[model samples]
Target: MTQQASLVALQERVAAVNDVLNATSVLTWDSRTMMPAGGAETRGHQIATLTRIARDLLLAPETERALEEAERAVLEFAEDSAERRMVQQTRHAVEHHKRVPASLIQERAALRTVAQAAWIEARSKSDFSIFSSFLAKTVELSRAYADCIGWNGHPYDAMVSIYELGETAASLKDLFKELRAGLLPILDDARSRPQPRSDFLFRDFPEEGQRAFGLSLAERLGYDFRRGRLDTTVHPFEVSFTRNDVRITTRYNRNYLPASVFGTAHETGHGLYEQGVDQAFTRTTLATDLVGLYAVGGTSFGAHESQSRLWENHIVRSRTFWQLHFPELQMHFPDQLGDVSAEEFYRAVTRVEPGFIRVEADELTYDLHIMLRVDIECALMDGSLAVNDLPEAWNAAIKRDLDLSVPNDAYGVLQDVHWSTGYIGSFPTYTIGNVMGAQLMETLRRQKPSLDASITAGEYSVLAEELRTKVWQHGRRFMRDELLERITGRRLDPAPYLAYLRSKYAA
Candidate 1:
């Protein structure tokens, strides 16, 4: 076959796999959002069947043949070319999956929905016993998965690499060490100041007003509603079937105003990345996570988180954002925010308060929440911690890290849905996102001298276009570090993140 014909054949095979994965994503999104409680079991089986089908298709003889032909066809292409990278990535995923059994894949997929349902009930009842057995089974399957994939260091390393390639327990420890050192003093400085008047933030605001404001905020931040949407979920997340259909969900808290507002901004950031992917790569290997069996366009979980954190923190949380948009928000909730000023609202939202919830945490204490989760995940994977003892371990860590008492399992060990959903090693990505987002923003500000002015004027297209060119357009064509190095001339570093926090909080 000619090179073009060979490449086209491989693309067709990969696109089929992408379709199955996208179908799985659609079901997964439903299970989390609108599915009835009793549908969990059948949904689990359905997702498992689709996941197994996608895996089988990826490893079939036809796919192997096409991949071989594409490999030879793309041999003369540049190393960084999308054609070469697609073949290379597909081959890696094939090899990776071949080491694991189809039964194991099906089992893991089947457990996700059931376990998530159990987690919701347990959380609602503030009961860990209700979910402990499922969690134990999940940990066992995760261990088996790590063994199948083969790991030389901590078993958690294998899990971590599944989400963020090249990250391990040891490496994250080093990164967290540097971050903790820089953050502690800054936290102290911020805490010593007189706290902002945040009483207004806890006042009653209707869900209708919050949703209207969130929708406007998302649109203003460049989230394309034509190809995207917003909904409500227990945990906020963004999922994409392809670039053409991306959806985000955020929870609403009528008693706390920042929950929906910032949550919408964060998920909109994720939607923007998916919507920003090159249309030419749709349904191709460049737009699918072959290893994770998801039709996501971002290069990695951490890279995806970078966009969410960037929009959530750097832009939406800025003084300029509230100053420009606060009038609209006040118009929505004139009764609740009648006495509040824009500057006061900004200060209240950004106030550095160490909280029990990671999602609701302030910027200074957010990474501390991530570090605590990483430590517990490592212990769980290594068998140093027991499943039943999780609440105790979680409470101790929360007290030690955030200097707060745990009120219950719902507010402590059962807070996050990651474990139940089988995202064992994904927590670190939030902190990595913070660091990467700051680094990128620093580079962006240096390169675009008018960035602050544009932001102050509430014009986001300038910033959005720059990010689309630098970070989002390539999809999975580059690794996390490669994208960072290409944009900033360096790999992931904590200096910029620490500098940003220090400048914002201490200075």
Candidate 2:
């Protein structure tokens, strides 16, 4: 066949591979949010089969030849266009998929399926030992994955790449080192300040009221209920199989208000990003971040965090924000919010607190939570840390950094399910994204200084639209660094994040 015909065939083959991936994505989303316990085994096999088929298609010799033909054509035709970028991205996927043994791919898929099931049981029983072996297997799988993928910088980099796309161990180390140096002293000073009163937030907020408040907040933020539905899950997360079928989950604590409220806001931010991706890009090679994996990795995650943080901190916790919504809150939880003034409520939510669980950690100590997790992941990958002793190590890190002790395993090691899924060296992205969010917010404020006023009045679409224009619509079309530079006029600077924390906590 002519090279042109070969390239056309390859395009069809690539689309078929993407179709399988997209189908599996739908199944995975369903398995996580809606599948019954009885369906785990069947779903596991289904996902495993689809993954193997997709890998084979991706690794096919014909596909490789087509890619070579396409590469030559792209280089000769439109090397600087988005089409060339898509070709390059396809090449990257082909190379990465071919590097690993198909057996390794299938094994990891099966293991992840089992591990997730075991994790659900262990988390339910609050028994770390039940999941320890599974976690060990996960570690073994991750180690093999690293070896298969290979890394120029660190073994950890190979593992981290699946999520962050181009992030290296060496780069993160330098970034985190600078972040720690700047943050630790400030947290130390803030720890000595009188803690703000937040009795209102800790008081009983009926679950029904929390759901109503969350749904209302989502609607106000421009989330379409027809496209997305909020539900309860063991952990709060947003999963979207398609733009129109996105789903978000939040866990509610009847005694703590922000858990559900901010969780909803955070996941809603994710949903908004999914929904905002230009519909025309859907089902094409350009559907997601095609700029570069690393760029897409950093900016997309950062963008999601920005939306969540904007609604959670800049809007939900603001005094004026409280004034506009406090009456509704009072109506929902009369006994809880009746005596609380907006100033009192705002101070309460923003109070500096060092906590064991990263998700529940307040703003001042949130990055510290991330740093501890980063250290632990690095240690676990490098053979210095053992799965069995993770709990003790976890408590030690908490005590050293937060001046707190683990009251129980539930609130300690079992708190986050990230490790259960073999997500190592990924937590730092939360801190990185938080900083990026603040940077974007700072830039947004400068561009539209009245943004705070709109947020205060519970008008979020204007700000959401602003973000949709600058960040969301692109959908991984630019590398993370270039995207940040494009939008904020600077590289990834943690100074804005540190500054935001300092002003909020140390001031």
Tens digit per residue, CA lDDT, model 1, 1-507: 999999999999999999999999999999999999999999999999999999999999999999999999998999999999999999999999999999999999999999999999999999999999999999999999999998998999999998899999999999999999999999999999999999989989898899988898899889989998899999999999999999999999889989999999999999999999999999999999999888999999999999999999999988888898899999999988999999999999999999999998999999999999999999999999999998999999998988999998889999899999999999999999999999999999999999999999989999999999998999999999999999999999999999999988864
What lDDT score is found at residue 279 in candidate 2?
A: 62
Highest-TM-score candidate? 1
Report residue 455 deviation for candidate 1 (angstroms): 0.6
Cα RMSD, each candidate: 0.6, 3.0
Q: List the residue pairs that clash in candidate 1.
A: none
Give one digit per residue, the lDDT tens place, for model 2 in 226-339. Answer: 988998877888765546666778888998898897788778877887777666545445453321111121134555666666566656656677778777877888888888
Alpha-carbon shift of residue 345 in model 2 (angstroms): 1.7
Which clashing pairs does model 2 show? 289-476, 295-479, 295-480
lDDT of 1: 0.95
